[model samples]
Target: MAERVYPKLIGARLRGQTSYRASFALQCVSSGLGQLVELGVILILFGRVTSLGGFSVTEVVLMYAIAGVGFGLADMVAGQLDELPAHIRTGTFDVVLMRPLGTLAQVMASDVHLRKIGRIVASLVALVWALAHNDIAWSPATALLVVLAPLSGAVIFSSIWVVANAVCFWLVEGQELANAVTYGSGSFTSYPATVYGPWLRRFFAFVVPGSFVAYYPGLALLGRPDPLGGPALLGWVSPLVAVATAAVAGLVWRFAVRHYRGTGS
Candidate 1:
């Protein structure tokens, strides 16, 4: 039942957005351009230096592409969770709760912004360009990692969105905090983990685990050894990290939902 219903829900939202064709197109262009600007910054920086933290311009672009696509997809799908506080404040959450669908499912499917695909498209182009420019040893494993890396990164990012936004159930004003963590993770993961200081790298790696989103998989894709001396096998552990993060997010979300007592308005 959910299999059919979720698609219908998403389809309805997609149709509504497409109804404003010109606006939709403009929004997509704007979104893609904005994302490209970030990539441009990396290129400009590399113009002055040959390498950053032992990574070339192309290698850093690979990281950016993976992280950008992951975050873009997550933002399109689960970013609506940021509005949970507004729904709670306006008492519309009661209506959401009365629906037959799972709260998270309905909330996620409520607003599917197709404009965010622009960011994904921009990053995908970069991914192809990076793959072409890099010295990759093509193999069955390498091919599989290339395909799975972005997807696993998406799951990792989406789980971060869920866990961070779940705080809204307790602190309706927690959106800023959640945005800091979620968007911050995206920004942090857009470069090689080696670029950052050890403390920042460790924080993201252990506390938030954003490193799994791009940096590790990127190492595997590029056939580069970890500059930090971590095992090469860590590159392939993104799927495991994504699954673990998602499980933890599920628990936090459920706990938050159960603790909700409404605003009593």
Candidate 2:
């Protein structure tokens, strides 16, 4: 039942967004431009320095591209989970719970921002440019990593979104906290992990595991060694990291839902 219902729900939302073609187009353009400004910052920084955290401009851009694509897709799909707090505060979550559909699925399907595809498109362009500029050692494994990196990265990011936002079950005001983790991770993952201090690197790399989203995979694609002394195989483990993160997120979400006692309004 969910298999059939989920697609229809998403399709309905997609159609609704497209119904106002001009507004949708403008939104997409604005989103794309906004993302480009961030990319421009990276480029501008490289103009002065030869490298950041030991990575060349092209290499850093690859990290940005991978993270951007993953985050753009995750944001489009699961970013609406941020509204969980608002729903709880206003008691709309009770209606959500009463629905036949699963609470998480319904929340995810509630808002599909197709405008965020602009970011994905811009990231793909950057990916192409980065690929053209880099000296990658092409192989079947490398080719496969290129394809799976963004997908696995998306899963990793979406799981973080779910896990972080689940705090709303206990702290209704936790939206800001969740945003800090979700958006902060996106920004952090867009650069070399080596750029961060030792303690901070370990936190984002192991605690949040943002390194798997782009940094390690970018290393694999570029055929570069981990400067921080991680094993070469870590780059290929993004899918594994994604699966593990998603499992943990599922457990957290279930626990949070079970703990919910409603707003009592």
- Against the true structure, what is each candidate's TM-score? 0.97, 0.98
Tens digit of lDDT per residue, candidate 2, span 21-63?
9999999988888889999999999989999999999999999
lDDT of 2: 0.94
Model-by-model lDDT, in order?
0.92, 0.94
Where does the lowest 10-residue lDDT sum fall in candidate 2?
A: 96-105
TM-score of 1: 0.97
Off by over 4 Å in 2: none
| The best candidate in terms of lDDT | 2
In the range 1-265, model 1's lDDT, one tens digit per residue, is 8889999989999999999999999999999998999999999999999998899999999989999999899989988988988988888998988977788999999999789999999999999999999999999998998888888888989999999988888888888999999999999999999989999999999889999999999999998899999899999999999899999989988888888889886
Residue 241 displacement (Å), model 2 = 0.5
